[model samples]
Target: MKRHFNTTGPVIPEQHYCVDPMTRLDWEDVQYLIGAGKFFVLHAPRQTGKTSTLLTMMDVLNQSDEYQCLYINVEPAQAARDDVSAGMLTIVNNLVEGAAIRLKETRLRDWRETIWRNSGPHGAFSALLSRWAQESDKPIVLMIDEVDALVGDTLISLLRQLREGYIGRPGIPFPHSVILCGVRDVRDYRIHTKHHEIITGGSAFNVKAASLRMVGFNRAEIETLYAQHTAETGQAFEPMVFDALWEDTHGQPWLINAIGHELTWKDKTARDRSTPITLERYRAARERLIYSRSTHLAQLADKLREPRVHRIMAALLTGDENLSGIPVDDLEYVNDLGLVEIRPQIRISNRIYQEIIPRELTWVEQSSITHQQAWYLTPQRHIDMPKLLSAFQQFFRENAEAWIERFDYKEAGPQLLLQAFLQRIINGGGRINREYGLGRKRTDLFIEWPVDEEKGFYGDVQRVVLELKILRKSLETTLLEGVEQTAGYADQCGADEAYLIIFDRRLNVDWDDKIWQRQEQWQTRSIGAWGM
Candidate 1:
């Protein structure tokens, strides 16, 4: 009775879940870590199924008769702040008891009580493994989940004890292999404890041998999940829907599931029959979900607002990929956050996130624009492009300043605002196609206005390519660069006309009211003012 789509973490029992791709992560390269009895760290972004992978790994290791394996979650122990060492003790005791219960060995169960009697939590953990290895004739492996939850001096003490105890291994003592799992690489930890002024966990826990990362589902996995949903519900997903979903999410597991979950559970009306999900429905569902500013979108927006994310995102939004040489902290931070993938050229990870950034940033501004329904439609039911552009000119003269301020990313707001203006006019029968990013020179927005005329006549396809430029360096320098950039983009899009709007916030000279100057056979145009 469980639906396949899950917005939260990995689905549990009764709920069908995909096998984590990272679960197949091998420890071959770091076998020395296991052999030396050193701590191992595995981490990734939240909800990327780190816990699920650990559990699966623990099960596999436990099945092997050579090693007794146990996975313990220390998240609950985090609640006890002031007495952190006591919290560690409590977590160790609980972990021992839980493992003993699972193993169902009375002697091992007694060992749990024996270990807890010791003064040190680390000593207790070591004792339990020592007893288990000696009695069962097998080495013991320990997997600690939410290891980062242990804070301050508690975290330091735990790491130090494990490092100190590494000397007693193999024949005499200590767990064979120790795995610490959390949201960040252990080497990046900056633990601040009341007792220790500033304890850099990386230096304290240099004993971490291997830092493994968990990755999300790929394209094949995405299709398989949707297919499973279709098989179960007997409701088909349109062919184009799959392509659209793949294009949007790019196999991001969370987004893939979220879209499906929203479409099936949230968007469906009571009277609507169990029908196949279409591309239109999927789009509507995504737009609605984004507009609602759900937890997923809100959290993503919050990341965008961070100073680290802000700079990198601004560069990406304005399509400034030249920061490749500039050592910006925000660039690295945003890349680490997985918002933008680091490659030969830094860019947003996928289409869905790329689409999300602009929409989430500009939704407030778009909502404020008054309805201009009359200007777009004609008596013959065809779109009036001249009327639409005239309206945009008036809008640019009036609301551009106020609207741009409302945008989350004011740098790219002007272009988005223009799109919003054009979108209102053309969205009725026409669609807008956008392409933007870093190193791409300029952001190219293509507005497709389709018009149906008489029977023999071809559909009036109006393609408007808008090129956005920022006011930095020099207008001539940027414009020369923009012209070449816009030319290439216009050629690719096969656009009939291209409008190069320079948003000059740095201009000191007064405008001559109507400054619409065209150059090079009308291939390019320049306009400057407060906004328009």
Candidate 2:
């Protein structure tokens, strides 16, 4: 059977086309660390193939006849919550079953119950591992996947238990090496107990040798993965699709696979080997994926609700550098979760995340808007640019205060409100593309609408550029700078209609003083201007 892109679970080598997980890491160095009895961490944002990598390592070690290695997802224990005894019992039993199947070891069957009853809840895990290490012919290697999924007291207990075993490794004969895998670094786990005590994960697991962060596939790796499909089915991806996918996803493993799945398997017509995947199909599939709100994307959207995530995102949305009240530790915490890029600029991880942020932030407002799609269309079925802006201006004047109060990102409330309003109107027949970042102090939006409603997105496309800015300078100066910027973006997008929106965030500005309805000729093209 021919294999395809995998987004649902770990990639089985014989059943899927996958990059060798070891290639993504320093294999020899990692092996050396484990051989040297180093307990360490392996973590990355969800679905970036961290589990697959650990499974690969287990296969390599067990096959080499050097270690009795096993990979078990202890995330199931997360349900135990604050019940430490239940959680630990579930985790140790999971390890025993995993070893019985993976290592063909029946030794656990010999002493499993005795160890559980005698060692007590707190000591059961340590006792079980010690016995296994002693009974096994080879050194034992243990991996706990989704380590962060365990919450509160359960997480604290697990960490301390692991630390206890680590401290007695050589003499007590516990697992030679262990790996704790999850989305956050060990240093950032703010584990809280029911006793109202907060314990840092680092102090609980201080014996850790090193923490390794897994990254997304690079452009070359993406190319190789895609080429596997071509080799298998004789179906090729157009050259442009690779570059487009890279730009849109920035090598995020789950997005890459999800997009690949949508283009190849989800669309029946695109599956035939004779029919190649085109850039248009890729774009259309991508839009579908976003709308599908697949599990991965939904989880990404949910992170916006977290306080640490909200603090960083609120600042990024408005082009602010002052993270004044946010804790310093929050930065690494967000980065470990892969919400933003750290070096180039503190911004959303990629274009998809960037687009999803505002849309997710304003879902409530978008749903509440009374604007109808058909109402904004001219008799000819094209969007009436001036009419739309006029509607927004009225909406802003009457409802901005109430709507802005609902948002955590009050500084970027105006930009988000506008996008929410635009998103509601362009629901089906068009797509709105956004560009904003740190220090930019402006939001750029491009609306791509199908002019030939019958031919749909295939025929002539209507492109309009909307540039947004906050009024910090003279009205004349802001408009002058905005018109120039709008004209430049319009030229880039080949847009015929352009608009500049300036938001005056100053205190006590009269509505009559701020409202404006007019158009200015910038160079050869006309630009509509709105003030709020």
Candidate 3:
């Protein structure tokens, strides 16, 4: 069977082109932790190969005589919610099934019923592990995936049970090591109990030795994974595709595989295995993936509705540097969700996310926009950017008050509205790239429109840059800074035209006072400036 990219589940080595899951982490550290009989947490963002890594580790350990490892997902118990009995029953049953399937051990299934009857929900899980460990010749390692998916008292009970087992360790008949895998570290779990009490996972599972995060693939790993396809099919990817892929995905595993699958399997032309994939093909695939709103991307968009996610995302969207109001935990939470990176600076994780965030936020507005693409095109087939901006100004004046109030992220209303308007006009014929972050104080929008319809992006292309800013300082200072910033971005993009749009959101200001437009020159560039 031909190996292909695996996007949906844990990678099967013989069936998928993959990077070795073992190399994604520090195997040495993992071995040390396991050997020391210490319980640890392994976590990363969703679909980032946490389950795959755990399964691979289980296989490697089971192959040796040193340890008997079993990997099971506890997500099914999430449906039980606060019902500890139901949740624990589901988890225990899953363990029995996993042992039979993966370890070829039927002992768990034989012993689980009596153990649950005697020990009950609170102690059954720990009792089951203790029994399994006692019977096995090798020290057992239990890897529990999606540990955070359990809710309320159900989650609390599981953690407490794990903590109870940790007390026995190697001296007693308990698993030698326990690994809890989830989208967030155990320390970040804010579990709510039935009595309206809050129990932090750290407090419940205080026996945890360490938390190890699994990061996404680096450049070399990406290349190695992609090269597997080239070797098998004889279809090569152009060198430029790698650069674009990196920018679009930042080595995200699902994204890399998704794009690869789209290019190789979905597009029948590229399936010939002789037509080398090019930069244009990669871009088209990316747009399709984004527009498809796949489960992964949809989950990411759904997170924006969360209070913690909303706080950080709103700050990033409006370029608000006063993040003092947002808690550190909120930032870490969003980071763990894979929505934003909280390192050198807080920004959207990658270009694809950056595009999705704004687009998803304004999807409703963009859909309602009834403007025609041809209306904003010049007779020569180029985008009439000036006319487009003028139309937006009129629209904003008429509807900004009503539409802006409708957004959950009201602070970013102007910026999102402008993006929706642009996206509506450029739906098929062009693309817009956005740049905004914590301290940017400005949002940069780059429009790429292919002047020739036949050639698309390969032919004569018109590039336009729009810099969006909220009036934070004196009018003169804001205008001066806006012109320089807009000019700088245009220069970087080598754009044919540039515009500076300042949204004056003061309630006291009238439409006559707030709306204006002018042309300005900075250095060697001419920039159009607008006030709103």
Model 2 — TM-score against the truth?
0.96
Q: Write the per-residue lDDT of candidate 2 for residues 144-169, one digit (tens) a residue.
A: 99999998888887788889988886
- Per-residue lDDT tens digits for candidate 3, residues 1-532, read 7999999999999999989999989999999999998999999998999988998898899887799999999999999999999999999999999999988999888899899999999999999999988999998999999999999999999999999888866576899999999999898899999999999898999998999988888988888899999998888999999988898888789999999888888888888888999989889888888888899988889989998888789988999888886778778888888888878878889999999998899999999988889998889999998898899999999999999898889999999999999999997989999998899888999999999999999999999999999999999999999898899899999999999999999999899999999999998889999988
Q: Which residue pairs in candidate 1 have backbone atoms (N, alpha carbon, C) closer than 3 angstroms, thus clashing?
A: 321-439
Candidate achieving the largest TM-score: 3
The local distance difference test score of each candidate is 0.66, 0.87, 0.91
TM-scores for all candidates? 0.75, 0.96, 0.98
lDDT of 2 at 288: 87
Q: What residue runs in model 3 are displaced by over 4 Å at the alpha carbon?
A: 169-172
Q: Per-residue lDDT for 137-192 in model 1, tens only?
A: 66667888887777776777667666756656555666778888886667655678
Clashes of 1: 1
The model with the greatest lDDT is: 3
Candidate 3: Cα lDDT at 112: 90
